[model samples]
Target: MTGRLWPRGLRARLLLTFVLVTVLGAAAAAWSSAGSASTALVTSTERRLTESIAGQIGAITPQLTYPPDQDALDRLRAAVGPDTLVTYRNLRSANGADTGLVTAALRAAVRTRKRLVAQRITAGGRPWLLVGIPIVITGPDGARTPSGIEVYAVRDLTGVDRQIDGLAWSAAGTAALALPPAVLLALLAARSVLRPVRELRDTARRLAAGDLAARSPPQGADELAELTVTINEMAESVQTSMATMRRLQADARRFAADVSHELRTPLSTLTAVVEVLATATAGMEADARESAQLAITETHRLVRLVEDLMEVSRFDAGTARLRREEVDVAGAVRDCLRARGWLDRVDLAAPEEVLLRLDRRRLDVIVANLVGNALRHGGPPVRVAVSASPEQVRIEVTDGGPGLPGDVVPRVFDRFYKADAARVRTPGSGLGLAIALENARLHGGDLTAGNARGGGARFVLRLPRNLEGA
Candidate 1:
């Protein structure tokens, strides 16, 4: 769950990582440059000041009297430099009242009469260098004695501080300028990398959704491009396999249709011969007459079965064309019953004005097959009802009989499926409901079967009102 809080997209994660790296690199660069520049400026300032102050001290010391009057010390301070402070123990010259920058240890070191010492210190929140040296004044004799004059120079470092601050700001600004270019580079890199991945994902989704033709174009010669090529190859394989399967299915259906068509001629001739034989059998012995009648009945059933097979083949081959015309639902239903001599057998309940643009022949075939199926397999009081809405038209057939077994309802409209699993001889070819379903689909509609409310089988043929859907 903690991973949910992380960014879900690759681009955002890449951009964030790039930005962090950029900022860290920039900050490091700024810090390094600022430190070097500040150190250099301070060193240069110290070197120049030390040399100048030492030269001035050398020139002024020999001209001074040992244990000099205050006037000599004042003149020594003036010769050092502007904004420079000089001190000799309790005696000082030129704005000497402010002496806080000098520490007690530095004053003691100067009293030792040893070497020159310099240290940086802050006075009144401004940087200053404190340099101290003890001078020996040679008397008129050939002997030298300590002058006890401790000279101090406090050099103002305000200008050096300002220069160092400016350098720091410049370094920061230089680092800041790098961000725009870094951001642009990050965006370009993310786009170049993620575009192909997005395309491949979309293509994969289309393939999953049954678009076998979906493919991705290979781009660069790198690994991503190789992946794209692999995906395209897989899609082509699927397309080829599906195409072969479809062609084989079409060939099988075509063979069945051709065989059914070829058998029709011989079947017709055989039917005629059987009819003639039936007439002649009336004069023959009783057992021979019974055999002739049995042959005749079997030949008729075979003829019907072959016709149904041909019809199914035509639907499979997409050769079944609709003859669309405006037709009243009630009229279509009534005509379907009358053509089969079943008007007196079934009750019709329909709306007079409900109409649709659909194939009349297919409609009649659908109604006849359903009514015949119900009558042949069910009890009396077969009822047909036609209903309509703005979007669809419906015809429902019901019969007063035992409803279908629970397991048979779902597969009742499958081709060659039988409600009775036992091999009891039945008149139908087991394709009546299947053909009716195909006819309904031809009109861009559907067929469904279930039990009616009063314990009977029900078949509803629903057709869309729009013929353009076909």
Candidate 2:
């Protein structure tokens, strides 16, 4: 039952759901952010590589002259760094020669008076960026003349790749740094959502346990607070209704006690007169004598009913007292069975010397009621058994009858709850089991009834064996 309450509850479900969603969302966000940052950093690195290559190629372009000048070519080659390449095409001979790394297409573009950027071209079994520049000389008429092209350069981007790797590591570090806070926030959010739901569950459990006044206090300005307020209102309504019911119950008990007390004296005098007439009716006609006997029996039943009601009222008013002492439970059960002349009719079993701290009179009442119930409604040959453990005493009454009806078993200990009609032939007040339950509770114990596995009804009473020790 406890497992069902927590695992099936809304608070636990919602907390789990929120935590899962937050963790997934945080992970997704981190992945997306890392991807975007990596892409932006890589693109920027590539752009810088392009710009650096272009700048170096442009700086050496103006220093080149036309008409196969070896001095200009040598100067260009010497001015360029080892990572840069210079290449020229001998258009007159349809031949290409170059210094450093240069592709055929770059040499061809220089010869054809076009500039080109050849990226990631293979050179000496390695990768390089080949930039081609065209040298244009102007005639006196401002016409363009193309001679040999010069100044092609290549820049190594190995350092750029290393910087990109560092940037990527940094981005990963940033993402890692963000996780702890996200986890903390997720935990807090889950707690905020679950706390009120937990309170509601606890309040609901207390209400089930008969504390109708239990309620949740509103906290924070959120939907959860509103839910708390709503639950509080519901608890208030329940508390009010329960208070009204208890007030009505108290009034009814008082009325029953007052009316019973008022009628007891008159009923006792009438009972005496009826008894005297019952003696004289022995000589009268058979029908008249039977009627008189029925009247006496009914009067006795009425007296017993009034007395039971008074006792119930006393318990209700908190005026019932127990003369507590250490006594043998087996002796009490035996005495009850012997006094009621039920020792021969029913099977009475007891442990030899099961001692308990209890009121002997109340114990007798408890045993008598359970035994009488078994004998009356529980077919015949009922069994009363007593057993004791280190902590508690257990008394069980089993009947071989049809057992209690399923629908009526739960309310059997309620006052005025008769399995049959109240005006029927049964010689018992329905308050017997109710009084027995009350007495058991007053002794800090409980009495419970259920169907036995072997097709009968069983009433089990449990009481603390040593109240003082407890």
Candidate 3:
């Protein structure tokens, strides 16, 4: 819940944190000042009251008789003020009003020590201060003794409390005043911090989107600036590496295209020579005939490899064009199987007449490659099924094999990738599935390979029904 409520942006969180800290600091200072001032005011008031009461009693004591009577007590109370209590030998001041303000503790302390003692307390929901002073007699020898005369005074502290409360409110006001400035400072700080971050973010996004030229400008000699510099250096390295890779790839493709183009004429002459040799093999001796057949077979394999490379070069150079036609998909698959002499070897489960507009030659090539791959690499009982939807047509080919290896599935359609590296010689030039996938994608469709549920390798080809503008 706290995570949900907390600010997600750096600037907002920074501002909130700054304001809270400022307000809390101001409040703490205000509270301390108020408490200290309140203590000083109360202490000063208590001291002054004690001194005044003592002075008044001392000035009037000489005029009263020793072992003073009611008249002396009444005179003492009148001189002290209306809130004073003067008592001697159980004769209390008749006119005093706040006698209850003095606690028994204060009275006992004053009587035992023969000195002034004061206490601050609350009465009638208001603050009050009580002072108890014991009068003493001095002999001719300058020795003092208790005189059994005590004076008590009560002073209201309501005014002091009001002053303390004002101080507290003033402190709170100061804390409140600190907010706007704190927020303003926070905004300035956030701008300074987040500017470089925003630039870095934009630059990183551009780099991810393939704009290798993107770079962030360093702002100041801080951690963020250092990070910006590092990122710029990394981008420079990546740009250099990508440039080198692209040059190498272009050169490699050009070399393959050149080789394939150069070999086509000689390969044509060789094919003609092999055809003549095939006709002459029946008349030659058994050993010579077998050697001639092996030579012919290798020459044909070489020719196929060169042809496949040429086709791949065309794809790489973006010269492969699609010729779309409205054709029955089932009939095309059947024709592909029949032409390749695989009609009896595979099971077909296609509808009689599911039609789509697509490149007929490309579809033929795709089906031929898939079925041939299954026959060459997988177990027997190959299955081919054709289906159609409103948007696309699907051709699924499966073989009763152990299924594609987990590591091989990902790279099955990768150009020239083979599962068994040690078994280098195979009938395929290794470009069959790759070329098939390219053709499928050229029609705005896709091909996928995986393991089938019934335990075999499965290849599914999906081509869009409409090839208009594709």
Using TM-score, rank the candidates from best to worst.
3, 2, 1
The most accurate candidate by TM-score is: 3
lDDT tens readout by residue for model 1, 316-387: 878888989888878988988998899999999987677788888889889989999999998888999889
Off by over 4 Å in 3: 45-115, 120-128, 148-154, 277-294, 405-407, 453-455
Instruction: Please say which candidate is ahead in lDDT: 1 or 2.
Output: 1
> Ten residues in a row with the worst lDDT in model 3?
93-102
Candidate ordering by lDDT (highest first): 3, 1, 2
Error of 2 at 93 (Å): 16
Misplaced by over 4 Å in model 1 are 1-186, 201-226, 277-294, 324-326, 338-347, 353-357, 376-382, 399-412, 419-425, 449-458, 465-470
Worst 10 residues of 1 by lDDT: 93-102
lDDT tens readout by residue for model 3, 357-449: 888999999999999999988988899999988888899999998889999999999998999898678888999999999999999999999
C-alpha lDDT score of every prediction, in listed order:
0.85, 0.76, 0.90
Cα lDDT of candidate 1 equals 0.85
Return whichever of 1 and 3 wins on lDDT. Answer: 3
Task: Work out the TM-score per prediction.
Answer: 0.56, 0.68, 0.84
